[model samples]
Structures are given as structure tokens and as C-alpha cells.
Target: MRGTGLAGPGHRRGATPHRRTISILTLVGVCLLALSATQTASGEPAADTVDTGFAIPFAGAPGYERLAPTQVTGPDQLNQPLGQQAADEIAGQVGLNRADALSEEQYRDLVAGGGVGGSREAAEVIDACARILTNTNGRPLYSHVDGHPTPSVLASYGLYVNTSGLLESPANADAPTRQVNSLIAPGGFVGTWLRNNGATHTLIALYRSAYTVQAVYGFAAQQISGAAQLVTNTREGVSSEVGMSMAPPLWIVNFALLYILNPSLAAAMPAHWAPIPSAVADAIRSSATGQVPFSDYAPYFQ
Candidate 1:
């Protein structure tokens, strides 16, 4: 019978060839499952799905002329949050030691003197912090002595500014409109106004006594005092963590704060980047607009 026609290794050894094929396929599937689990633990996005088609809002630039009455946030989302975080850290350090370092009278004098004995870098950081914390639109009130005078652009997530300025200062239902305006007249109050409008729970800043500022939320005053202290201490190198990590490294923190307070600027910031669109760029140049219109950049937000 031709030696039973069973060629030794050449013929398939299983009783059912189809069953053997299925068994091999099962083994391959098991190997793939183990590999997928490893990828997940390492923080990798899954192979079957990818992060796409979703963008953090980028307004390209503010548009002053097209301003509408709606609440409009300027581009600094990342810088605003990072600024708050840095400010909070600075505040905690200052609060712990402010009383021992100087009397209330001395502290007042130092702040009035543009933050004396502090690193000029520290002074600028404080200014940057105050700007973001106090910003209404993407524009903070003070301009940087060096670098871009307007608020930093923000493209990533964090805090953002509304250009309209009006949104952040909507009159408190229970408080007189005049009472609210009283807090806004000085070169400050952007942050305080935002708080009054229920946009945030708290806001803080370190400002010169020259500015007449008030917080609609009474408790925010204490927070401001603490923030001022932090700015003072960081400049003086009083806090080791701030001195070692944040002060000398003010460039990083300051840039980061700018990124948070004005996300659009942050996006537009950095060397060799394209300028924002003409309209957006022009609006940013015109601080008077306070913020850009939502309709112009609605696509980015969507």
C-alpha cells in the first residue's frame, strides 16, 4: 500500500489539520494580549486608538475691533495656572517667616520701593505673577521691563483671560455697582474682578501700595498679603526652595506663569515662532480691546 502513505515529518502530525491551525492562532492571540498589557503600564496610548482631532483652544491672537459683549478669555490658560501654583508656593514660604523678618511698617516701605533688596529677577517674577493673577483679558495691567510687554500667550490648559474685562467684573447681585468699580479703578483689580464675578474661588497678588486695590471677597486680602510676602522673600533669597528652585530659575517659572495667564501668548511666544494672524496679532498689540471676540476664534475652541 506504498508503505501506508505516511511520510514521517512531511505529513501533518495532528488528527485534524484545521484543529491544529486553530491552536496555533490561539497561541498568537495570547502573545498579543500580553504585549498590550505591557504597553498600557508604560503610559502608551493604545495601538488601536490614537489621540487626534482634539485641540486645546488656540485663538492665534486677540481681535480688538470685533469685540462682542460675551465673556472672552484670552489665550493664556497654561501660564495662569502655573503662575498661581508658583505664587501659592511663594506665599506659603513668606507667611511662615514674614513677621520675624520685618515689621508691618518696614514691609510696606519695601513693597512701595518696588520690592527692595530683592533680585530684579524676583521683582519681575512678582510682576508677572501679579499680572496673571490680576488679568481680566489676556492683557495684564503691567508691562515687562524686558521682553513682551503684554500678557504671555497660553495654548495649553490652565487659566485663561477674557478680553472683554467686563465679564470678570460683572456686578455682584448683592453689592452696589459703584462698590465694584471702586475696586477696579486702580492699575490693578483684574484678578479681584474675576473673583467677584464668580469665575474663581480666590485670587492673589503682590502690588505696590501705590495701587488702590480691593478684593470683593474679604478673605482674598489675606491671600494677597501672603502672595506679596512670597514675592518679597523669593527676591531676598529667604526661602531655600524658592531660592534654589524658583528664583535663580525665574526664567522658567516666569515663562511658565506667563504660559498659564495668557495661553495664546504662550503659544505665540518662543523664538522663531510665526506671528499670530494679523487680526489676532493687532488685537494683542492693542491692549485697549481687553480681549478678542469669541466668534473669530470659535473654531479653535470648538
Candidate 2:
């Protein structure tokens, strides 16, 4: 595999020892900080509307096919929380919720061993990523301040505000900016997107475990889902009251769309992190859904 690790301004995730036995809930808590996702079309909060200037150009670019997926006719604000809204929008034959979420049951006859490997293999990558995600753009990934809009305590159980440049605005809105509106758009960040998209696969090099490629990739894929799901769910759940959304929200309808729409995400993924099972990639590239163009992400297939 092409061995260039995550490329960006900073690239040194402390290699954490493999975590052999992390409960799903514990793993969720550990990874909740370093993740992010796009926002759903419906009920997109006034604060999170994407800047069309940057997003429009991206939509016109080679890969993006349509802003709204085939299933969504248009923006219809629904009561469902952000995470569930995104999941529902991307389900059916049109999406890969099971694959992206790393549901082992979905593996069927596709992979050898659930494709995720043992617990230690997955934990090493998770710990490495968590160390890098402790904070982004200088703001704590998890807000310790508590109160409305901004909190005064570690409020909301553990569901705190995500001020990272990934989902929220960067610390310096006036700084020289890139056309990354697609990455941070339709989120609280209206001006700029500057957070680091942690590439979990890069850790393979640090750990020197080329053999664990599949496990690393599987964990990374789950991280993408977790990052987006947790960030979207927790951030959108913020209210006058201090509490967590038992159910998080979602940004994009399909998880695959986020990779295409946000080049920054592509930059952060594994060099060889392809469709976990050939089927998912085929579906995304087949032109069947008519949501995104395979041309937009041709390199991924190759």
C-alpha cells in the first residue's frame, strides 16, 4: 500500500498500546471526542447552515452529484434527532449504514473474521486517535464549561459541546481560509473549517503492524461513524438545559457521501481503506443511488 501517513499541518498521534478489552460504551466514550460528520438537510439549525460559496463550488466539482440524495426530495425538517435523522435518510438499498457502522452481522459471506480483528488490534488505533483528538483548534473537543449555549460544568452527563473546527468554526475566522466549506458547513461553523481529521489508518505505520491492516481499517471506519454520530448528536443536542441527547443526531444522509464531499476526510483516512466489503464500494460507485458520482472519488476505487 502507498505508505504516506495522514497529511496535514500536524501529524504525530502518540502510539498508544493496543486496548485488548474495551467495552463498547467505554470505547464510545474514549472515541467521542476526536470525531465529526456532515449535517443532515432537514432542520439544519440556523447556526449550522453551510456557506454556499464554498459548498457550491464543491458541488460543481467532479465527484459531487447532487446536494440532496435520491431519497430526499428537499429539505424537510423532521423531529428526529440529528444522528437518527441521518441514519434514516441513508438506510435502504441507497446506503451503507451497516457497513460504515461496522455491524459484524452484515459481514455475511463477505469477510473472513468480521473484518475487525481482535480487541487489542482495534484498541491500539483507538487510543492513538484519542490522544490526537483530545483537542482541536485549541478548543477542548469536550467542553468543560457549563450553562446554556456554553456550559458552566461538564454538563449533560458527558455529552458536551463540540467547538472543534471540524464541526464548529475555527478559532480564527478571519485567518487565511481554504475552500473547505464542504467539510465544516451546515454545522455551527459558518466562517472557516480548520480542525484535524485524524487518519486512524496512519497508525498502522507507527505500530508497525502492516498485518493488522484490516483491523486498523475496520476500526477507522467505525471511528468515522462514531465521530460524525457523536459530534452531530451531542452538538445538536445542546439546549438551554444541561443534558445529553440520549439519541445523537446526524449531518449527512449517507456516510459515504461525507468522504466524497469532504476532501479533508479523504486526506485523513487509511491509504488503503477501501470498501470494507467489496459490495459497499460497488454500491457507491455503481451509479445506482444517483446521489454521488463515482468520478468524484475515483482514486478511492483505484
Candidate 3:
């Protein structure tokens, strides 16, 4: 018989086969557990399982056709220009002719007091506010004026129709020029309109007053609530999110090539590298249909 020693053939002292086997099994079990956590019970990838590291299905451009001023319907006319419709609506609200001009005192009083009564001046103020809040085509108007002007600051100025037949600032007039303060002032016409109209709650926020002809013209750009509807209902559509990380700089060139050469490959590319197709499909569909599919989804896009 061979001598029983540490190096004996039948009893190798350092060889622990059972321990090695257990260690290997434990590692395999951990890997399987991790894989299971990332997958569904049926072994399918979960809808949100693909954590690409950043938000996938990025928001593309608006899906609907942004209707021009003449395409949208007005309260008074079937399809009136946005400016004319706004003026008409303001006139109706305040009991004034659309073409009527506001006197210096009336304009001043309206801005200072807000649209309290159904006076022509109050109507003008309301109209001006509406224009500032929305554009002629009935979209939310976002302005980039330098500073936010107060109602008092606005009331200190006067509005006049210059020789160019447009509402302009007077060069040397007895009265000062006026401007719109914001979408809603305390006890002002805009605040009143916002309170009365339930639909305009989700529209754009107010901006500063620039007190320029272009700024004044922006008021006539669109109807406040109607444009809001167009934006909230029609323009913006359903959106989805995914997780992905930012791509390397070189990915841009690859993405372009993949997009041009192999659309499916581009679609399959990492969200950080390329835009997901499903995210932009609605926009493409809308471009073809010429109308936004607002009814297809919920009220807000998310």
C-alpha cells in the first residue's frame, strides 16, 4: 500500500472538489437571477425593459398641420382670418364694432381699470390681451420681450393707428403709448377671460411686454382658446419614452448612413444613436393625412 501523506494519490490534501462545484453553481445562479430580473416570466422583453440609458421615443415635431389664419373657423364666420376673428370676438365680448378705434382716454381707462364693463375700451383691452395670449392662427403666443411690463406701465402709453394704417406708437402725440402687460393681471381682462373659459387652462404661459409694433401685432396672431385647442388637441399628439445614454460623437455619421442605407437598421439602432421609428410614425402619418389624429389618443400627449 502507498504511504498516506499530503501528496498521496488517493488523498490529495488541497483538492476540495465539492467546494469548487458549489462555487461554480453559485456564480451560475447569480447570472440566471440577473437575467430573469431583466426578462418577463414568459422570457419576453418587457415593454419598458429596454433601458437604453436615456429617454427613448423622443418627442418629434408636432403631428398636425398648423392651420393658417384663414383656415381656422371663427365664432362669427366659418373661416375668418385669425386677426379679424380675434377683433370680432373682442368686439362681441365688449360691444364694439370690429373696425372701431379706441380713444386715448378710453384706452387708458380700460388698461388701468381692466375690462370691468362691456365698454368699447374694455373690449379693446380684452382684444389686445387676447392677441398677446394667442396668435392669429389660434396657437399659444410665446413672446421674448426683455422685461415684464406691469399694467400701470402699459397704461402709461397710448396706441394709435399710424400713417402706415397699422397700430403704432405716436412720434409726438399728446397721449403716451400703451402695451399689454401679460396674459393675466390681477382683476384684469385676461384674468377674467381665463376664469370664464374652462378650456384655456392648459394654454401657454404669459410673457413680458416688449411694447413694439410687432409685439402688438402678435396679439392678433391667433385666438386664445381656439389656438390652445389646436395646440393641445391637434398639434401635439401621443408620445412614448425609453431609456438610453447619449451616443458617441461618431454615432451621428453612422446614424445618417444607417438611416439612408438601411432604415430598419436605423430603427434598431440604440436610442442614443438614432431616433426610434414608432416615436415619429404619428408625425409621418399626419403629414400624409394632412390632419392631426387627435381622436386617436387622450387629451394630453404623454
Best by lDDT: 1
What TM-score does prediction 1 earn?
0.20
Provide the TM-score for each candidate, comma-separated. Answer: 0.20, 0.23, 0.18
Q: Can you write out model 1's per-residue Cα lDDT over 59-158, one digit (the tens) per residue?
A: 0001110110111135433223323344333323222111212334432332243232323433333333334333333443432322333333322211
RMSD of each: 27.5, 21.8, 29.4
Where is model 1 more than 4 Å wrong at Cα?
Answer: 1-80, 83-85, 89-181, 184-278, 283-292, 300-302
lDDT of 2 by residue, 8-119 (tens): 0111265332432243234333323212232332222223333222121111111122222221122231111124344334332122222232223322211221222323
lDDT of 3 by residue, 200-221 (tens): 2211111110111112111221
The Cα error of candidate 3 at residue 287, in Å, is 38
- Per model, state how many residue pairs clash: 33, 21, 20
In model 2, what is the error at residue 43, expressed in angstroms?
24
All candidates' lDDT scores?
Answer: 0.25, 0.22, 0.23
